[model samples]
Target: MTKRRGERPPVPEALPVPVVDAHTHLDACGAQTPEQVREILDRANAAGVDRVITVADDLASARWAAQAATWDERVFAAVALHPTRTSTFTDADRAELTALAARPRVVAIGETGLDYYWDYSPPAAQHDAFRWHIELSKLSGKTLMIHDRDAHDDVLKVLDEEGAPSTVVFHCFSGDLDFARACVERGFVLSFAGAVTFRNAGALREAAAWVPADHLLVETDAPFLTPHPFRGRPNEPYCANYTLRDIATLRDVDVADLASTVTRNAERVFNLGDVVQSQ
Candidate 1:
């Protein structure tokens, strides 16, 4: 059966254990009001995606993401000016983001790496913003969530030049096997998105399969890369379950075991011990 391009994929069976969607964009997923955010989280929770980190691409979305984290116990936020939106980066913007990074529930400063694929932001501005974000992550003692797209070398170079934060994650990791190994070597986490499930993404699957359990994570990158067989459809956090199962299959690991491992990894990566205990 061919699913319509505009359709939303049906939720897959619930996982044997809960896991976290390491990165997603609630605002981009059409979640505006508190009710909408709750509904999204409720749907994700039902599928064993108990927690999600809604990432921001700009100051507006950053504010919304930080605020949305408070709407539900299951939701957390990552704030930053995305690489593509950093063309006009300013000190005022940095100050605001610095303040947001200190929020208790804003667990990461990110989605702020290099993106050579998009011409929206100049390379120079992106590098400057990425460096500042690295410092902010260190200062705030939060995980640094990165958004690397077709700029792997430059991304690595900048992080090296700036000295990456203690906890750095490559959101929607688009790197190949060597890049994956490089990231693992640096103690940075690699988060796979739905794109890893695509039939044409053999290299990505290889990278996903090879990454160590402790350094691995999963995300939907929703409203963007809906997984295979549902490509072009609308995506939400619940879709992460499908991506997780596929990754487990790729790694030849039991789904439940992989779920447990990734859940634990996410908890530690985001410092969600208190949140998990509260639940």
Candidate 2:
């Protein structure tokens, strides 16, 4: 049997202050049951990850994410079919997501942009689903969370053509400085994940350092993209502190200050001010 995602990586020391994980996947992290979710959150809280926005990649995961958000007050959700799954996305999936998006705890519609790196779905289908999700986000009054991997130009082009929703965020942002500038100019939030802490991620760090403080966000993208010194290990929300500390250090700012800034940004984007409070 495969090792469960929750089995690896020793939790790091807690941060000086709490911060929000702008994106994560509790299901992929192997915290599916109510007991498992509560335990996972307890460990995260100990590491100062005060709040989390768990995201989904398909219809089933979207349902799980929506339910998880209501399971714990600190948890909120982003729901959509992933780019690769777009080829199989159906009217039923759309209806399910539409209903989930209406729930107060389901705060965003996404992980739903383009992924040219994978051939699971044709470009046309991915683009079609992306446009539909963008519209759903706008209609439901939820932030549009994006997943652009190896398809930056097309992602921007589609957004330009579609007239983006009120709020857009690029989760697990994997772009260079120029692309970062393009996104920032358009007022899209760039969410940095654990990959930013890798040694080969110099360009990513540079992009992050230059992002206007208010436009920057941090995440774990956990059970994957485990941060430096733990790259091959499984990850969980408790590890967000590692990524947040690295980002603060790279930007030459105080960790606590950066924590407050990102927490504020997450709250504003997800409209979670009353939902997740500072610790």
Candidate 3:
């Protein structure tokens, strides 16, 4: 009933310039070992996707992501427990995440935030965990990576009440033009994934095109949200080129120029100087 990544579309051609995958899941993509991680990065690099921000959904995956970021110079990480999995959350979980968030290579504290679409976690628990994560992001001084899905209003409410970190990213941004304008007005960065390239995502594309260059970002959210002409396939960092190219074409800018802007945004937001060198 489901298609494995191997059964999905093949990798596309390389981009004109290197860009960072604003969000991804190397572990889910089957990069379980250091060698596997390197191999994946190699394929990504060949496609001009030189760096990535591997995201975590739970504590175990967060640890995996943190360790994976060290596997290569191109891999950075985000640490957090996803809102959908907060049903069994405890103080111990927060304690462990707090420690993991302090890791030097852990550039962002996120893939957190609310998700009303999934009923796995109670609304109250998800809200509480989101508040905790916001505190963690503040305490650790790391960028906050938000995973908003059908809960944009609550997500914004929490951010307003708790106050957001210095740099915040709406990973896999699914908002409409009005929502996009609202986020941009607050200086939040939006990372568009493959959904933007979908034919039915015209509103998303319009919102993306309206975003200021500095506030725009591109990601694959891999093994999922695979770009058009390959929507059913497993996504990887390498596939980000397709989304990048799409956005560039939509905005009528050079792909290289867009890449440079997004790469710089990723570098500054995550402070991944080790993985993102001057180019």
Candidate 2 to native Cα RMSD, angstroms: 3.0
Off by over 4 Å in 1: 274-279
Give the Cα lDDT of each candidate: 0.91, 0.90, 0.89
Q: Which pairs clash in model 1?
A: none
lDDT of 3 by residue, 134-173 (tens): 9999999999999999999999999999988888999999
Please write out the lDDT profile of model 1 over residues 30-85, one tens digit for every residue: 99999999998888988889899999999999999999998888899999999999
Best by TM-score: 1
Question: At residue 267, what lDDT does model 3 achieve?
Answer: 80
Among these predicted structures, which one has the highest lDDT? Answer: 1
lDDT per residue for candidate 2 within 1-279, as digits (tens), equals: 123444567777788879988899999988879889998889899999988899999998999999998788889999999999988878888899999999888889988999999899999999999999999999999999999999999999999999988899999999999999999899999999999999898899899889999999999998789888778778888889999999888989999999889988998999897444521
* Residue 210 in candidate 1, Cα distance off native in Å: 0.5
Q: How many backbone overlaps does candidate 1 show?
A: 0
